[model samples]
Target: MVATTGRGRQGRGRQKIEMKPIQKETARQVCFSKRCAGVFKKASELSVLCGAEIAVLAFSPSSKPFSYGHPSVESILERFFGSSADAAPATPPRHPPAAVLIQALGRQEKELQERLEAGKRRKAALEESLRGPQWGPVGDLLGAWRS
Candidate 1:
């Protein structure tokens, strides 16, 4: 068998290509799809391991939109608004009309209240579980077993 020569300029053979921006249309499209999938996968792993809420919005080269959210994009966005509103100053920003500002603040407030109630309920359940008689006193366990 004859030995093959070195890589040609067209790169017909697989040569180490640069990681720079892809110039060719077809190659760029393929790269975009692959990279987007990788980004979403990494984001999923990050949220699962860290218990983090994440939301991602991406626009493809063709102006197509895509999204990835752990839990949900809406929930994460609502939490963000609730946290931001909590830290906001008394004076509302001048850009948006007062009516819009008031409406947004009201929504954020409602969401914050719901979140707080949920937390309180969870705490109550946990506390009640701790007080349960599942594994009462060791002496009681021994006495009951003996009887």
Candidate 2:
């Protein structure tokens, strides 16, 4: 036998909640926690999907603060405030610090050089193998094969 309740098999799915203040303190705190989590999740998604930098600051009914940020709140706040300060540069830097960039470029250059040397060594070994008495040159080997 199929089980059925007065409200149907599954009670009213999701219902639209009225947007207003919750009177109960415990309920309001719960709601605040849940909503803050949801807001943070959306902020994270926005940051990942659109590469957006976002910082969220929220205060609960009790006056406690909640915060969210892409990268870090401090960094975002620094960038925001630093850009406005009189002593700060007219424009924020477009790239990483010069020393960091130089180090990264140096590592990449070294890796590329290593790859080049390895490729040269491979080519030399292959050429040496092909010069054996049985093989002769690549052109001659192809010619002999075709015949």
lDDT, residue 141, candidate 2? 80
- Quality of model 1 by C-alpha lDDT: 0.80
Task: Please write out the lDDT profile of model 1 over residues 42-138, one tens digit for every residue.
Answer: 9999988886778888998888998898778776666677757666433333268889989999999999999999999999999998887666698
lDDT of 2 at 125: 92
> lDDT per prediction?
0.80, 0.84
**Which residue runs of candidate 1 sit more than 4 Å off their true CA positions?**
1-19, 82-147
**Candidate 1 residue pairs in clash (backbone atoms < 3 Å):** none
Error of 2 at 102 (Å): 19
RMSD of each: 16.3, 10.3
- Candidate 2 has an lDDT of 0.84
